[model samples]
Target chain A: MIVAAAKPWEEIMASLHGMHKVLVVGCGGCVAVCLAGGEKEAGIMASTLRMQRKLQGEPVETEEITLTRQCDPEYVRELGKKLEGVDGILSLACGVGVQVIAEHYPNIWVAPALNTKFAGATLEHGSWEERCGLCGDCVLGQTGGICPIIRCAKSLLNGPCGGSQDGKCEVKPNECAWNLIYERMGRLGRLNQLLEVAEAKDWSQGRDGGPRRVVREDVKLDD
Target chain B: MSNRDFAPKIVAFCCYYCAYSAADLAGSLRLQYPPTVRLIEQPCSGKIDIRLLLQAFEAGADGVYVAGCLEGDCHFLQGNIRAKKRVNAAKKILDKIGVGGERLEMFNLSGSMGPRFAAIATEMTERILRLGPSPLSTADKGEEGKAE
Candidate 1:
């Protein structure tokens, strides 16, 4: 899942300076699980914005709505009926969610409330680390299920790079990703897979050149 | 009422498992505490989101305190930890908006601490009294009534 954090309040306030009625939309998927721009976060942002507007003597009316999944067109379309009177929308989802909302309702102006970071998982309560680079390849089978593409500072393919020292990445003081993969494979009795050489990652399926899309005729709207 | 005669309205969010039971014990014991504090029982400290805490202040609460189970002893394992993070975050926002971070606090206690609960009630009331009435409360009393 994608990891994101809310942008600074000052920047958000600046974007909606003259807006009177605004709808703060929250996504209940990955962002919700990560505690970023979920329902609770959207409510907080709405209240804070209302308070800030009141302090400035500007009468701003803010409402909140949390969708099941903002990235899906079906979920975003559910907001069409509620968008009747709202002047604008403040999306508290990832970049994909924000774009989907904009694409679905072109008439309503949409703004993102979070800075989409990367695809990752929580290490603990308040900490998260990047886990996948989405390089259009999966080398976890060779690297022992741990992703060195993201965890390693240098995306080493076969084994630890020269920068690795004492089972730690020299670039940072953190434990080497390859070392974790090696240990995991050793435990699983799959250490022999690490001996095979790997090739450079193909960048076509990733977001390097342009956007990517997926379509299925069986699940088409008309069908 | 004049500024000097202001009565600070405080909202105390007590978790059901600990603080709420402690309040109940205090009542049964006839413990003397400030009437200025209004208690709202919540399922767990984690359920008390930051928005609710700020909403209490926005609804004209001079001070807000979240009473939760002690650290490492939350009934839900880590609910108290989440509550602490929310309180700290709300405090930062309050400070940023000139409301003074001291207006919001998080207290930890067990279900049997009736005396401790009363002490916190008195302490929060006195602290708010010293801080005077919240600016929002002075500007608009009817607004808070609408929220309720």
Candidate 2:
């Protein structure tokens, strides 16, 4: 799931400069599971803002709401009338939610309450490890279940990079994804897959293409 | 409140398996620790997230600490280790926010270490006393948040 971290109270305060009233929107999607921007988190953010503003002698009134998924237009659109008088809107969703809300409500001043971290998993409670780089062209089939694109320090495809020592990545204590791949392949008698000489990844599918979109014509409505 | 009048509110999140038992033992032995230290029990210290830690500070806690099972003895296998990393991460944020990263801490101890629990309580209380009150608390009561 996409993980996120809350912005500092000071930075949040700075964004609300003249806004005396605001709405804090939360997403019940990936961020909610990651414990970043959920209904509970939204409430906490509103409370923190009030506390900080009170400290600065500029207490602001805040309203809170958590949508099923802020990325969808329906949930956010349902909140139209609620934003009527809010001086601003603070989105506790991932970057996507903030952008979606901003795009839908061009006139409303919107600020992000959380920093979207990465496409990762909760290693343990409170510990999230990045697993996928979202490189568009997935190579999980050829490289065991692990994606070397993000797990490998350098995202090496052919073999373990020199930085990998005793199965650990030089960047962190994590095991080299390639080494883990090799070991898993060895056990599965699929070691031959490693010798397939992979081709250079197509860069067009990645961030180089700028904003990406997938049009599912099969599911689209006839407008 | 002024530094002279600040007593410093410290909150401790203790793992039920270890730190909680240690606290129980401390009381059993009648160990004398600072009264400023407040203990909140958690199933595992791993449950303490950055938000929870920040909330404590936001709610007037001058200092906050997480006490978990010693290193490799976590009841949930790796909960304490995860808690340690979270504490470290939160500390960096504390440092960046000018809260004096020293205000947040993480400690590891077994259920048998009653003296250690007492020691930690005293140590955290002293550290917080020196740091005075949290900037938010000070600002709410005094002139401005000072931001430190």
Candidate 3:
């Protein structure tokens, strides 16, 4: 899931400056599971905005709503009725959700409440760690299910860059991804796979190819 | 209200297993404590979340505190511990929102500690009195809200 954190209070406040009424939108998808932007968070944001603005003597009114998933058109369009008198939208969704709302509305002012961090997995109840780089490549099978592109600080294709100390990455406090991969491969009796030299990844398959879109002809709906 | 006559509105979220019972004991003993504290009983301190804590302040609470079982004595094991972390998180938000983190606190005590509960009430009341009213509270009271 994509993990994100709320932006600073001042920045969020500045974005909605001069707006008397605003709609705060939360996504019930990845941001919800990550505990960043969800129904509860939307309430907190709305309450804080109302209280803080009132305290500041601006007194902006806010309404909170959490869409099923802000990334999809179906859920984004559901917000139309609620936008009647809203001066702006404070989106608590990820970057994709914020863009979807902006692209759909066109004329409404939209601002992101969260700084989209990374494609990550929950390490524990409140801890999240980046796990996928979204490199548009499949090498997890060869690397023993850990994507070195993200887990490794250097994104080394072949093996550890030799800066690893006590299984921890030299560049960061996290465990060396190559070290984890080596151990995982060893435990699976597939250590022999590490002997082959890996070639450089295809840059065109990733962000270098520009914005990505997937169209499934089989699931196409006649418009 | 004038500075000298300021009475802080303190909200205490007391866990049933410990703090709530302790408050009850204090009442039975007729111990003297500030009447400013408004108690809300909870199943466990862990039941308290950031939203609830912030809402208390948003609702004009000058100060708020969470009272739970003494560290390891929580009826549900780590409820008090979880509450402690949440209180800290809320404190950070409070500080960020210019309300001052000193306005919120977390206390750990067993159900047998009636005197201790009274002491905490006095201590919290004194602390809030020293800090004056919450900026949010002052806003509600129609004063120019300013956090000291």
DockQ of each: 0.42, 0.18, 0.53
Q: What lDDT tens digits, residue by residue, belong to model 1 across residues A152-219?
A: 99888879988888899998888999999888999998888888878777757777778777789888
> How high is the lDDT of residue A182 in model 2?
97
Per model, the share of native interface contacts recovered reads 0.37, 0.19, 0.52
Evaluate residue A60 in candidate 3 and report its C-alpha lDDT on the 0 to 100 scale.
84
Check candidate 1 and list the clashing pairs: none
Q: What C-alpha lDDT does candidate 1 achieve relative to the native structure?
A: 0.88
Where does model 1 exceed 4 Å of error?
A188-192, B16-32, B43-46, B69-81, B109-116, B139-148
| Chain A, model 3: TM | 0.98
Best by DockQ: 3
**Ranking of candidates on lDDT, top first:** 3, 1, 2
Docking class of 2: incorrect
* Clash totals in order: 0, 0, 0
Q: On a 0 to 1 DockQ scale, where is model 1?
A: 0.42
lDDT for each residue of candidate 3 in B49-122, tens digit (9 for 90 to 100): 98899999988899999999998898999999999998998898887777888999999999999999999999
RMSD of 2: 6.1
